[model samples]
Target chain A: MKKMMYISAVTEALAEEMERDESVFVIGEDVDIDGGVWNETAGLLERFGAKRVVGTPISEGAFTGLAAGAALTGLRPVVEFMYGDFIHVAMDQVANQIAKARLMFGGQAKMPVVIRLCACGAGTREGAQHSQFLESWFAHLPGFVVVAPSNAADGKGLMKSAIRSDLPVVFVESRQIYYDIQDVPEGEYTVPIGKAEILRPGEQVTLLSFGYACEKARQAAEMVKDKVDVEVIDLRTLKPLDTETIFKSVEKTGRLIVAHDSPAMCSIGAEVVRRVVAERFDYLDAPPVVVASKDVPIPFNDELEDYTVLSVQDIVDEIMKISVGII
Target chain B: MKKSSVASPSAEYFYRWMLAIRHSEQKLKELYIDHKIKGALHLSIGQEAVPVGVCAALSDGDKVFSTHRSHGHYIAKTHDIEGIMAELLGRATGCSNGYGGSMHLYNYEKGFLGGNGIVGGGISLALGAAFSAFYQNNGQIGVTFFGDGAANQGILHETLNLASLLKVPFLAVCENNGVAATTPVEKSTSETDRTKLAKAYKISSLSADGSDVEAVYAAASKAVAHLRAGKGPFLLNLRTCRWEPHCGIIKDTRDQKMLDDWRTNHDPLNVIAGRYPELLSSELRAEIGREVDARIEAAVAEAMTAPAPELAEYKRNFGV
Candidate 1:
């Protein structure tokens, strides 16, 4: 096992995939020389050369569409959106063109394109534009494979799987955990898409989350360990959701608390809770709770941003509330 | 202008392809009116020369990305009338297997990257294809066809700049069909000369009479040559007219006199046939017309009899 930062894991995965596949190429703003704003694609330009490591004009719609086109042909393109919020600028290309290409074309085309978004949330204090986790928006789309890995190991493994998949993937990497280090397995291995990882196993209640929020869920689980036994499941893949894992956990625990950095309304947490309620209604010991960011835009102010974002305490409170009789 | 005494076989082929598109569009219009074909239908009735001419200059390995008014482009590129007909009829045998109707038609083997419903959607897609060709050191180019409506979209300018900067083997063919649906080019953009947009990006461009198939072919050939020679991107503004409404068989709100003038003087088939009267003689014209009609009839028969896509197939595609 090799210890690496979450950002380095992403870069390593890209380098490894490019080395393995001749068709794999990197394209987007500041990706070539700049090595991406977060340096997630560092060393790719030198290794792959100018042809593969393409630095596009700051035209999100054009480059994103271009990546779709490249993917349509023989090339496998990994598009880096400097920030996840920039996806809105190229919404038509991302939501309509790339995502809908395969299904709309009757599966004749394989959209093996990976869109890497450096999704920053709350604590960054980059204001409403830069700090927003919009995974739910893409998760709602039909033809997208949404992945949000919390740590280095899963980051490397899942990215490899995403690049190798035939379908278009929205790979969301949180800037909050860019430097977070973890032991990634040596050499090649892929964390399969559409599977949830049980980070910590317990029996009292289930604490489900993804991306950076998984860190907070683990912390919350640790804090409430003595009082309430909590099972934490990091949903590595958001779309084609690992519902089987979630259902099994909810069925065991009989209580659930979904968490994420995105807004509570129309969030991944909402979907998780909705599914659990619809499927495992009889298993419920108490009403489920979704611990998520407020419905307002993430604030620029530090205090306001902290208030707007989901906190570890919030998860703890939800666990305590649901564990009323048990505790 | 230098004129040939006898039209070459290619010219004759262009003439036949243009006629096929014209007849197929007319058949589609009739089917739509009779409630045979449902959903949206955008026909390139008078603008057949643009696709036929541009496609004539492209090699077999080269790719073509087209806009919503794509019947002409699809028919010209693949000559798969039955595939397109079946697609519009939502049959399992359709080019896109009934998932894509009149707006979306794909044939990857033939290098037709399918038609996009969005106005300027295919511009950058073609650029990517060109980029791929350039990367692989393959002698292939990608040609994207858009109309006046899509010319104003930001993606077009963005793609032009990128294509020029990257020096990819890309061709942007703007079929300037006077008006974009109901909005005239004059009303949409102050600078109506679309070639200027390409020139601003330092990309070479040319303007051709879209009504004349030979003229379009000549200009497109120059553009394709420039692209194949690693001369970066080139844009061809084919000045043409839209005979039908933007979508469906609706009455055109344009000046009747203008439409009549275009139909009378600038009809692509008439312009080509008038130029090559001997090559497309009355006997040959009748024979070609009979052949085109028979093909259209066969395509319609196939589409009419083909089965609608099963729900299980749709479910499978949805997952895929």
Candidate 2:
């Protein structure tokens, strides 16, 4: 048994991959001396030295490209963009180069790189500039594997698998999950990417979410237990999504509700709806519903920000509405 | 940065690269005029010293990732003239099977990783490649090249911050020609000197005369040497001149005059070829020209003979 937290799980995952594969290493801001912005990589520099745990210049585009080159040259690299939004700067590296290199090059190249991004808004008073959920932006890309684990075990196992996968992986970790601890085995383990875990078994309504939203969804599941049987799905990997589990659950339950902190329009939610509507249209008793952040920039004020985002009450209320055919 | 007198043999190679690129420019311009090529082209007519100087410092194992303006990088790293030409011609034999056009040439055998279309995009990826170099314990490095316009991109600065803070063994070469689209570097950037921005990362940094082959070579050589000796990531700004009207054609006579003046008076290849008439006639020069023309003709023929990727084949590339 291990008592490691989510952040520690992330560190262990990277360290394990680095030890397991000679071609695996890490680079990002404050990763060497400070052990990364979130302390996930603490003590990594002392063990790996400056070469493997490389600190970079303030050139996101250049370093992102560097990582892609490294990935192409047979290295499995995990690069951290301190904030999720900062990934936009290195969009060329992730979306254009690393994501498209394999397909664009006619399968002549293999891009096995992991990009780690810390998404803010974990009930921390960090303001709008620092707090925004951008997983939908990356989920829109085809070649990328987006991982966001809400639990400690999934964080370690999924990250390890991401580093090992023969594709560009973007691991989105929630700031809320750092100290969030759960039971985990000390033995080596790997969680498969592109598979959603059914956290709770139910028969009335299915709630889909990942990362921080999973916890809220679980809470909403409890809140609506007497009202309806709400099945909760932890969609750890956003891209190359496990639509099978979702659709299967929706087919059985005849109702679906997607709950995430990200925006609604043109979001991962949109893709999920498209997938279900395309394949399992008759399964839905009514139009599927999505509870998400408002379609606007995340505000600075605490109350407004909270109002803009989804909560257990909001999710439970959405479930109640679906139960009563109110929506 | 290392400064040298203009009479070195390496200087000749640099100048020749510039001239060959110019020839490519002239050919591309004529093609555009003849309506043989489509899409907006971003030519590297005056930026010869950058690719030649930096690539000269790297070995075959060290990889290079480039941008939409990538013809110079393609030529600098390898001799895939036919493949590149076919790509420009939108032939099935093109590097990307005519799917990527000019912005996605990928030649892995020669360590040319990719030609990306996004600005400031491939930097982290290059750093990742260097990370692999460091992990594999390979005596190799990854060189990622971008432009001055890319500097304004937030990712470029973030990548620098991470590379410096992490000490990744990647080298960043900024070919600053003072333009991002129609916007000049001075107007867009509060600090026109990009090297200073690199220095803020507190990593090893330098700026060089990007137009001068010898200068860029010296600076890049030192950085590569530092990388070879197990130093961290390094940043270098190449202060060069762009001798084309962005690419292909220009309606502005002033732009045309600038392009013409740069082509005629400041041709890097002609500068060296003029200096070394003996070397100019040497077997190496003959080999380069012959190789270039033959490859170009082969590509044109291949493109003309081949079929476009059929609709049935679109599923292969499009991931439908």
DockQ top scorer: 1
TM-score of each: 0.98, 0.84
Candidate 1, residues A104-168, lDDT tens digits: the string is: 88889988999998856768778889988879989888889999999999999999999999999
**Reference interface contacts recovered per candidate:** 0.80, 0.78
Q: For the second chain of model 2, what is the TM-score against the true structure's chain B?
A: 0.86
Which ranges of candidate 2 are over 4 A from the true structure?
A1-3, A33-39, A55-66, A82-92, A296-306, A325-327, B1-20, B46-58, B119-137, B144-242, B253-260, B278-291, B307-318
Q: What docking class should model 2 receive?
A: acceptable
Off by over 4 Å in 1: B1-9
Q: Candidate 2's residue-wise lDDT over B1-320, tens digit each?
A: 22222232354466556556666656666676778878867788778878888887776678787887988888777756677777777777877677677777878777788787877666666766676666666767777898877788776777677666556578889888777766777678898877688778777878887766767888988888887777788888887777665655764333566667766875556555666777676666777776666656666776777777676777764557
Give the least accurate 10-residue stretch of model 2 chain B, judged by summed lDDT.
Answer: B1-10
lDDT of 2 at A50: 77
Q: Model 2's lDDT to the true fold? A: 0.77
